[model samples]
Target: MAERIFIDTQSANAMIDNGSAYVIDSTLLQNENSRIKHFENRIRGAKYFSIAEIRDTSAPLSLAWPTFQQFTEAMIKIRLPNDGKAVIVYDQTGFGTAARGWAMLKYFGYPNVFILDGGLPKWVAEGRPTETGEYELNFTDPVDWRQYLVTEHHEMRVLIDTVEQIVNQKNSGDNRFAIWDPRPPNMFQAGSIPTAVNLPASTFFNADKTIKSPEEVRELLQQHGLGGEVITSCMKGINASLGYALQKYSGNDHAHIYTGSFEEWKKLKG
Candidate 1:
């Protein structure tokens, strides 16, 4: 396991310069227009990987985790580093998208993955130099990553059936679990899973896009009286992973992600 889940921009820059790390830009790309402009130039030599490419799009909820084989193929296509190199992932929005990448890599048993704290915005704000153009994937022969993958990590994910069971349990006055909704306050207000508490993921990040310290995160969750086994959800699962990551960093190893989230929940209700 990696000693830490995040790296400061200065540390990331030094790692890149020393060729000890491989940077991954996880920002969403649409028609070649990405939220992180000049991304290739901004982080010279950074590879690009779309979160969609590793998702189960055909499912009722598009953000659901990919099948094992699907995940393997995506990893190969991206030519992920396996030579004991540190893999650092970042996105335009602080840890939002990047945390999903971190979670995916961790679930697959990548031992040295980390999120670039504050992401691209913070890097650029620090006046770091960026390059332009797409960085090509360095294809390597495929290795069976399944051997290294954490198969039991799936146990931490909740599907529609389990979610329904949880709601029932809550209704029956069992509070063994707590659902943390990381969607915006308004979106959470519009509709959310029954018994889910709003704890917008944005609250876990500093204004500059860096994640709050573990102590701060612990304090915030404690202030809200949220504890025990926590299940994080959002409109989809992207932001939910951020909440889960925070919980894990704050010493809550039992934190889980409701991958189907409100998207599948609403469909089942309908």
Candidate 2:
């Protein structure tokens, strides 16, 4: 069976209105646009957590995986539904930082998660409503959200040691897994681990930023020798999560993200 990957803006809006869904904007408010913090408006009732917010602050690394303690604490702060509910993630574009939020939620065991196909741009194009102003840190929930705090889900992520072991296995004869690097080719070729391949995440998106069709995605991944279980890695976990989402959308659910990515890998390996 195929794993679900995306939700259209209309269906997503309906769910958000009916209180069956939570929307998260996982834009990575840095690098090329570091000064731009909150956007002017967001999907109605959407809680915004730029990738930087969910990032692990326990150390000096960039966007390292959040610890269980950090994740729970942040969710509590967001007043995320205590009861299990659908979470729809998005970024400025559909395929960028949204995958990070999706990956994190899926890793933590949220079963009904999807990325908003085409993201906020698509939502606005269809005349969906949005809310203005900076996010309120003290927004109160009217439901029993007080009781639905999450338990940490640890099964979908691989650590530095696990990645090393995979490299060793590949150097020998194992081909059961592949590390799918989604960065630019030059960046990948310059310094990537053994058994990793360049499969840039950008190829999975359409011109308007919506994800490509499942058929197209399958072809692209297959062409790159990406099948079965995969570990998606990049400079940070950002692009890695995109690869994970692409695979899941293409019906291959065995993919995992090396959440610390090459940044963490290099640090630990050194």
Candidate 3:
């Protein structure tokens, strides 16, 4: 069986203390301010071991590159004067930035990664626990992952392409890919990529945002040609990540997300 992923905070804390699992706070990047403030106030001086701080700034290349290689290497270089410990993440919410980071780590071949459920809000609402303050760390290595690693937006293979790619390919007679847009019909914007079908992300989730039943999910995928090469995107990448999650959960194992998404589209348009 696949490993069970947990989202509850108390359960996460117990697992961490007992050394059974690592935890990730997969809240959105835009929402971190309030969450971290709560963590600082309520947790009775809880000291976080390993936390990922993701900010909302474009890199020199306009990607989330800061957390990709330099951040990981820093973690590796720092030998805390203490024994080995579990890594934890504290994420604020906006567009699943932290959650996406956790997924990226898993994609990079890390053995274990998990996101904090309900993030800081859920933790406070349950009256469970909290911690505070900015963390202090010193970097020793200046290695950059881009030197050895490259993330090709076009090469990811799982993302559904824009209408532009579809039209171009159709004109060229390649005709091998299909597009699926997971946004709501109204928000789908004016000119969908040619050959693209609509499949709003909302239909795949319950009112609470959890996934729907397998039959329903399968139906959606089947309507959109699930078995074919799949790529997904939304306004930024949040809806796309949810779409990617549903695709993977629904047995479309090869689904990919166009991380820059329509946000990139508008930039290119201008």
C-alpha TM-score for every candidate: 0.88, 0.89, 0.61
Question: Can you write out model 2's per-residue Cα lDDT over 1-270, one digit (the tens) per residue?
Answer: 467788888889999999898888878755655214334767887787656777678777878778777876677667765466899988865466888888888776677889999988889888898877765654555545455456566667788899999999999989888889998798887777667989788888888888778989998898888977788898878888888878888888688878888887778786
Residue 161, candidate 2: how far off, in angstroms?
Answer: 1.3
lDDT, candidate 2, residue 111?
Answer: 75
TM-score leader: 2
Cα deviation at 191, candidate 1, in Å, is 2.0
Give the count of colliding residue pairs in each prediction. Answer: 5, 1, 16
lDDT of 1 by residue, 165-248 (tens): 888999999988888887789989988889998988788788887888888888898777565678888877877887777787
Which 10 residues in a row give candidate 2 its minimum summed lDDT? 30-39
> Lowest summed lDDT over 10 consecutive residues: which window, candidate 1?
144-153
Clashing pairs in 2: 82-148
lDDT to native, each model: 0.77, 0.79, 0.51
